[model samples]
Target: MRPTFLPSLIVLAALLLCGCDAPVDHYPPNELYSLVVSTREMVSTQVAADDTTAVVEAWFGTPVQPRWPADQMSGSAAKALVRLDNLERAAGRVYADQDDLHFGLYNEHCVTCHGVSGGGNGPASLLQNPYPRDFRAGVFKWKSTARNARPTRDDLIKILQHGAAGSAMPTFRLIPEQDLEALVDYVIFLSVRGQFERELISGAVQELEYDEARPSDGLSLMSIVGGDEESEALSFARETLDRITDGWARADDAVIQVPPETVADAASIQRGREWFHSPKALCSGCHGQDGDHPLALQTNYDDWTTEFTSRIGITPSDREAVRPFRSAGALRPRIIVPRKLSDGVFRGGDDPQTVYRRLVTGIDGTPMPAVNVSDQPSATGLTSDQIWDIVHYVRSLGESE
Candidate 1:
């Protein structure tokens, strides 16, 4: 009465034959499996600094332009304008007019801590425990590479997108994707323009040094025998300026695509909440019991900022040195500073994925440690899904706070 073995055998054979041409595996193609773009491919065509203004007007509608004295305009102001123009173009449609974009982007995000002109003059800049950057000099403290030299465009992008783990520069991922790109472009434009201006002034000083020397002029106490000869010194100074200018040109001209927006989900938020409160994770210590609690938790504790700085090997003096150069405003309760998450600083600028990157990787040289929950059987390091959830939670915090 059961089905006959011969019929079943015939059916199985037919099914197998039909499926033979079909793929046995359901996995995606190799390329689709990995979304990372190679660095070399990402490099953009170089645009000339002189052409930037034309490009800006062509791309984005004209708005009020900043007026600088004719003499000042020849130097950094011109460069800043060019760079700003180029950035506006690359950022697509977010920036209406250059000045408006500049004021809006910098004021709400950077000026609160770094000050309007980056002289560390912003209201909150004064209150920061460490102070803000003075953009006039163009020196940066936290850099991507170990050398701590000038930051690359990519470096700046990373900092903007993810924020410095222990610093007040909140991850800017929350900014609309286009807006974030525009912001990144603008920041670099400012730094490059500022550096160029500084270099021009430095060149003038070097010229003065050369003029001061006589036929019998000897090396100063600072320039001993091991130092460069006069000709070499002149060459070196020129070369340094050349390098800075060249960097500006390249950075201004390079085109970069904005990263896509990352949408947050629910499961990740639940997990993130747990991790935030867990002793092993220790995020709750500073962030507070429920992340909204007012009492200063270990994570938020003033001492932790110092400890975080030490862990990253950043000296207090170094923090002070760069404080004035920051164009972004003060690191306050609501403003981001070198340490502390006053306001929703850490949660402010960035998107879900960027937040995930910060949580997973921690920062290169700061107190924020990598959160690795993979080892625990009961918990798992946040998957992409979980990270999105955390993003929702963080965003919710913004509304509630």
Candidate 2:
């Protein structure tokens, strides 16, 4: 039973279609999930009336009056994750105070495309071929970490310094370092907040009894266990918060360590070419032979689209099946075709080390896969040396003929 937000979106759409009101130029209180839903689990929870908003609000506070969850996260933990001052600067609408000093850095520069809560549904979002990156998933594409690992802080800073190639994300290199730091901190804040919401919803689905007291009674997810600081519910909430924050704290340790580049001798390049098309490599499956000659180019969806569509059994190509969703505020599906390797434009940086990392971890949220490697002495998979050959072969493909 998925929660349907169709009615609300329908009303909004009708208002627009009938020209009943002026265009929506500003979005107030860009709370996550206010415009577009975040996860299917969230949808299901809403239907069951098992929503976790009150609990999440209790932990993170409302968009207007944001809280820092100091009881569970403070001092060093808070510092490592995000600075309160920086986050506050980036959190709200663009404005000034008594001295007219600028606040709401995020809203000033990012909200039009990233939405208030970083849901990637900002007013200008759908106009782009690929919508802006949604930070809530806590999964970033151009990162140094291995599969499913949290992105290191440096990984984020680098992205800000150099905008993601082949996308509408422009570089903020000219901005002051402090502003960049604030934006990055705000991104982490939105990501952590989104993940926290999903985790709480998931936990409630698994453990919450239908008869449990609701938030109106002052007993929601966090205080539901016994309504006290020493209660089991509070402990569970604290542990969950700690787990999420600890992962971010440990992001540096999870980066893939790439071996030095294998010299691109003819033989090495030849072996790499063979491995590129090898049955086991599977590179040719989506990216065709020699990197871009598929029998017929097929449409592919990134992880964000997969989250709500194919993952939930809604076929992406079936228009009739998808119209309701779009009308209800889901963005129109955009095909993310496999990159033509021959183009030689690597969005995740073209350097050997970066490419090497991409090969080892694969591109997050795409069809690209990490090469299989044999870690065990007797295990059967591509060894590190073999992967290096493939890397060389890939780099060679980009070289001018």
Candidate 3:
């Protein structure tokens, strides 16, 4: 069965009956909506095929057709997909209530903008100024975990609860908690799937000489022909899946726990200012003197500009709001300019805990990196106290403004 927006509408009606206030309509454009519906049809057909293996192949298969003679669903690749799909199915059964709603929750609400494969290339993606997130790359802009780690579940949930301040992504706070959990699970599923697919493609292209032009390359698994190669390929696939899944599973374990609240006083603020200017943190490098200014041309591009401009036919000359998604398609490609910290408006909330998470997680997809400090001793990292001092300093920048 195909999914519909009626569930959202139903929720809206219930809200009205209860006198609860909430956003009734968060629908995307008709073109994007149609695209999602069609994509679901394709998925349903693939899943409904008599051969279950075909479902695995189609869902996890590479976008690039291999040119070489290859088994597209090699034994090892098949094993990996089977395992991952099991988890996906389990997540679906446990989190999502129905079949049609499985991954499409993320697809309709997210994929319409974030992309079916999480590559941030949804039909409407290019229209937005800051293009939607490309989950395939596994780089989230807002996180509360350590470097190169998955965003903590709470981190993902928080973003859903409170949407990003300057983006097209809306807050899903009003959705039932179960629905929210299902969506988050599906998103993580897509992220892991996309990342693994990337790894498999890279491995096949590099090691197996995947070529699409070869007659034997049609839907064949990237199988290993020799004994040594087979063992190596199987080992490699297992290791890759482990690493990818483990990174996500371990995110919560690595969350940066802030120490109890402390007063943002003169001494702490002074210390923070010093840290900001220090070569280690390099706050002054981009956010020059008092966070209001940058020292250079500041050409840093956000993920949107880096990935979508050329695809959408946007050019350097198009500066003002020239995109449809932004300013109703009137604005130009939006630049992901670094925030003016001195302005005192924190897009990710100004609360102390939020500030600490940003410092630790280093806003996922953006250029802003997490501070190199921990509560424990490290020759290279900072202690929690040090980060607190810096946080105080940043907070002060807004106050002084």
**Top-TM-score candidate index:** 2
**What TM-score, to 2 decimals, does candidate 1 have?**
0.38
Q: Candidate 2: give the clashing pairs.
A: none
Q: Ranking under lDDT, best-scoring first?
A: 2, 3, 1
| Candidate 3 per-residue C-alpha lDDT over 1-401 given as tens digits, one digit per residue, 9 for 90 to 100 | 23668788898989787542221122222222122222332322111121212222444442221111123333343233223332333231113446533433453366557654556666676677567776766777677666677787777878888887766778888766766775676567667665655555444334433333211322223332222344544455556666776677667787766677677899999988988888768777777887888543335555444433433444523555234333322223444566778878665667888798788777766667767775585656777777888899999887875
Number of colliding residue pairs in each model: 39, 0, 28
> What is candidate 2's lDDT per residue for 17-55, written digit by digit as tens?
755222223222323232123244433445213345655
User: Model 1 over residues 92-115: C-alpha lDDT tens digits?
Assistant: 222346554333454346755754
What's the lDDT for residue 179 in model 1?
59
Error of 1 at 148 (Å): 7.9
Report lDDT (CA) for all predictions: 0.41, 0.70, 0.56
RMSD to the true structure for each prediction, in A, is: 26.1, 8.0, 11.5
lDDT, residue 66, model 3 = 10
What's the lDDT of the predicted structure labeled candidate 3?
Answer: 0.56
TM-score of 2: 0.80
Number of clashes in model 2? 0
